[model samples]
Target chain A: MKILVSIKRVVDYQIRPRPAQDGLDVELTNVKMSINPFDENAVEGAVRLKEAGVASEVVVVAVGTAANQDVLRHALAMGADRAILIETPAVVQPLTAAKYLQAIVQREAPDLVLTGKQAIDDDAAETAQMLAGLLNWPQAMFASSIQLADGRATVVREIDGGQETLSLQLPAVISVDLRLNEPRFIKLPALMMAKKKPIETLPAADFSVSAPVLTVLQIAEPPARKPGKILNNVAELVAALRAEKVLP
Target chain B: MSVLVIAELDSHGIKAATRSAICAASQLGEDVHLLVTGNDVAGIALEATKIAGVSKVLHADALAYAHGLAENLAPLLVQLAVNYSALVAAATSFGKNVLPRAAALLDVAMVSEVIQIINATTFVRPMYAGNINATVVAPAGLRILTIRPTVFEAVAATGGAAALETLTATAESGQTTWLSRDLVQLDRPELATARVVISGGRSLGSAEGFKSTLTPLADVLGAAIGATRAAVDAGMAPNDSQVGQTGTVVAPELYMAFGVSGAAQHVGGIKDSKVIVAVNIDADAPIFQVADYGLVADLFTVIPELEAALKAE
Candidate 1:
């Protein structure tokens, strides 16, 4: 089985991003960036499948500007066989990203596609299912555990209330969730070696880019909550909660 | 223009989040239609018809949709999308799974996790894990959206008497097959819809500590149990019990956190809770910043005392 995993570069999870001065988007000037946490899990899962001899090749893809190559390299350092960066400076929406990925899937002809359940940046969580839809393939979203065998993938998905298992034929997309697996740390040697690995760059213009269906009108900070008070002890806490009528 | 809202269903009937979806759809326009698809969802369809502001209910009953697989449900949604100006659903797991696929098939962009419906084409949603709110405007065509149930108020359940329409089951795509499910049987309310939620973090130590320390308080208050990502990662809580950006975003009346450090990811999920109470040994835990009330103490001792105090009442 050949697995293709998709990743994105986003503001580090540790950073509590504030809106930009124009109130149009988050401040991304000189902030620490990293691979989306869920995508890291996806990469780690795909790598593990290859390490287990179940997957023959693992290819990683990202859709963004050249800066996204950093995330693709990180995936390479984690044991992806090759990397593809679809270069575009435009704000790639989910549908656009899905279209770009569909082109990649058609070219690579991988048996499975792996992606993060949602990106930490947009939190859209749409690309994988959209890709599945466009390709008329099946999708398993929020997969906590995935097992591949006999041209089928059994995925344990995280639903609202509990977990549901789904078995999909090959050429399916699986969006990985947290608790899937801990991403392996990149060693100094692997990082050094990954720096030399060639990444294939494809211009977004090469493929027909559709007009954006949705445009961001504005972005602003949500109203902040009022500063809360600290009680002296648990008794005071209970009294305050009761006074607030939150506790029956 | 009319809006079509997909109903989120459980084993019983229409889920509470679907009611909130209806409320969001009603904001879009007057003609708010609902689609309920499942194996045995006649009762669920009937329940959907009673939701206030809904004008019609489209029920699709088939074994293919029994598990609500996106492969089977998305196509039916595409077939039904032509009549409405927009498609809407609560951003639950089901909605999150099905809507984008349908949107892709329709060749339109989807605005997900919407918190506000500014107009028929514009919406307000959170990005970067709820730190930044972005207002998005879609082109003048069919729009797809998934609204955050926590942000929208659920419409009343017993008001309108909408007409019911049955839809023929879409053919099985044969690309995916339903397997087994392992759902945690909860004695208390589900976390997202619960009136009160009691969450713990890594300091809970082990799965035993979560059960022994938190269950009593949850039982006393009739609250659902929640956990921080650290606690869930530590195996102290199930994956579904995790309350965070990646886990579950909850907006309960009262949210109590024991030993939670409140990382940005976790805080994003709970920021919508009406009253947040945090108890932790560390005085400077980030959770205290967003909490409505804070107490600096060890949770192991405080949980039992708080439970006793509530039980005494």
Candidate 2:
């Protein structure tokens, strides 16, 4: 079976995000960019499928600017057989991204597609399912474990109360949760080898998908929490709590 | 102006977050319609109808909805979206997953994890891990929103005469099928949907400590146990149990912090709770700012005493 994993280039999760001066969106200048953590899980899951001899080929595909080449390279260094970059400057919404991916899936005709359950930036958590809807494919989102055999896949999803196990047919889309697998780092030697690997670049306009229907009007920073005050002793704190009806 | 509130139900019954969403829906004028889609969810619809101010309850019962997969439910929601001015769902995993897809299908923007309904078209939502609050106005006509359950109080169950209407939908079997379910059946209350939450931070030391010290206290109070991202990263708790900017956002009636030096991310998730009480050795911990009650004492000593006091009560 062939595997295709969707990756996104997002602002580094570690940095403190600040709103732009226009108060319309996050300021991205000088901010470090990396492959979204969830996408990393997806990439890692695809690599595992290859290691387990379940997948014949693993292709890592990313949709973003030319600068996202670094992120696609990272995936290639990890273990993907090849990389595809669909270059676009526009901020693609989940539906638009899903439509574009549907076109890609039609071209590639991969049996399995993997992606992160949600991107940290938008926290939309809908792309994989939306793609599944657009393609009428089965989806196992927030999948903690995946077992493939007999043209069917058994996936364990981490739900709100507990874990739910689902069986899906081949040619399905699965979104990886954090607990699915710990992503591996690329060694310097592997990084050097990745430079020699081939990356196919496709312009977003080449896809028949249209512009996003919804537009982001503005992005603003949340209110800052007030600094805490120190209490002298436990008794005083208890008294204060009782007075405030918190500890009564 | 009618509001459509999506009702969430599990095996246990109606989720508390859905109750909160119902309350939020009540605030948007009087014509509040509750939409329920699931197998054997008639009981859930019956219970939702009891909540005050609910005008109608719509049930789309089908076997395909047994798992409540977003792929299948999004289209059903789009069909219902035409009648209501705004759509509301709880910010639980199910709501977060399906609402966006529904919004996308409707070709409209979604305002997620909303804390307040500013008006018909505008709402207040937290962005950047709750670091910044964004007040947004949805495009005119219809608005799609997901409410953080903790922000609103549950509407009182006054046993209103809510009219129940059954709607049929074409079953779209996706690539997936539910095989089995393994729920971590906790005797204690749920954390995100609980009225009271007692959370421990990295200062608890280890998972053993959390099990020994925090679990007992939580069990006695019938409260949900929560942990900071530090504790989760330290492997003391699973990532799903973590409460922070990236994790679950909860606003229980009462939130108790133990040995937690409230990081901005952690505070952002729980700051909406009605009352906060902090128990930490360091008096200057950032958690005390939002905490209604602050205790400067070692949790090792204070937790046992607090548990005993609660037990005595």
Candidate 3:
């Protein structure tokens, strides 16, 4: 089976995010960038499938600027057999990204495609399922675990309450959940080998996808949290809750 | 203009969050129709019809829709999209999974986890894990959106005239088939859906500590158990049990934090709660900022006493 893993370079989750001075976008001047944490899980899942001999080859695809090559390299170091970069200067919306990816899927024809449940930056969490719909393929979103046997893929999805297991035919799309696996680190030797690997770069315009339908009007900071009142004791707190009619 | 709201149902009728989404939908327009897609969901459809603003209930009951897979539901929704001016659903796992696909197929913009509908054209949604709120405008047409149910109150069913519509579409599209479902049966209330929640942080120490100290208190109060990212990362609770920016966002009537030093990421999850109470050893924990009531005491000592008090109540 050929596996395709989609990755994105996003603002680091640890740092506080601020809107750009233009007030239309996020300030990315000096912000630390890394593979989206959820995407790392997707790559790790693909790597595991390859290691288990379930996949014949694993390809990592990223859609962004030249800076995203570093992210593709990281995926290569982690165990992807090849890398493809769909270069675009501006950040693409989830729908546009899904369209671009669907075009790539048509060309690559991978039996399985894995992507993060959502990118940390946009938090849209729509790409994988949208791509599946665009391709007219079956999809299992937020998959915590996956197993392949007898030409079918069994996916364990993380739902609101617990888990639900589903089986899909080959050539299905899946989005990885946080509990899928602990992503492996890139060792020095693998990093050096990754530098020697081949990377094919393509432009987003090459794909016949339309512009994004939604437009971001403005970005602003969320409402500030109210200052907390300090109580002397648990009795005081409980009394206050009762007074507020929350504890009745 | 008619607005279409998808009511998500489990084995137990319509979900509370779906009711909240319907309430949000009512805010959008006067003519609101609800679509309940599942097997043997006629009772759920009937219950949904009783909500004050719902004008009709559309049922798409079939074995194929039992799991409500995106591939199956998206097409069904796309077919229905042409009839309505706006489409809305709860921003749950099901909505997040399917709505975007439906939107893409209709070639329309979709706003996810919307906190407020500024109008028919604009919406407010959290970005960067609630650190930023982006007010977006969709290019005018049939607008699709997923409402964060926690942001709105579920409007009570106040007897409304409802018409039932049965939709049938033959499509062999969903590549996935449900094999089995393993629901974690908990005697405790569901954290996200609960009216009251008691959450613990890393200061509680271990999973054993939480199970022994906090769980009993929560059980007594008839509240759901929640955990901060610190506690979840420490493996003190399952990922599903976590409540934070990265985890489930819950808004309850009463929220109690035990030993939780509120990080911005963690606070975002509970900001919508009607009343928040924080208990910590440190008087200056950030949790106090958003908390309506605060207590300065070691949770180890206070929790047991609180449990006893609730038991006495």
- On DockQ, the leading prediction is 1
The best candidate in terms of lDDT: 1
The per-prediction tally of clashing pairs is 0, 7, 2
lDDT per residue, candidate 3, A10-106, as tens digits?
A: 9987877899998888999988999999999999999999999999999999988888998899999999999999999877888888888888899
Clashes of 1: 0
Number of the candidate with higher DockQ, 2 or 3: 3
- Could you give candidate 1's per-residue lDDT for residues A108-195 as a string of tens digits? 9999999999999999999999999998988999998999989999999988778899999988999999778999999999999988
lDDT scores of the candidates, listed in order: 0.90, 0.80, 0.86
Candidate 3 residue lDDT tens string, B183-265: 88988888888889999999878889877888778877789999998898899987888997778888889999999998877
Supply candidate 3's per-residue lDDT for A161: 90
lDDT at A38 for candidate 3? 92
Calculate DockQ per candidate and list them: 0.80, 0.41, 0.69
lDDT score for residue A6 of model 2: 97
TM-score (all chains, Cα) for each model:
0.96, 0.90, 0.95
Return the candidate ranking by TM-score, descending.
Answer: 1, 3, 2
Stretches of model 3 off by over 4 angstroms after superposition? B282-285, B308-313
Which whole-number lDDT from 0 to 100 does residue A40 have in model 1? 98
Superposed by TM-score, candidate 3 places the C-alpha of residue A18 at a distance from the truth, in angstroms, of 1.9
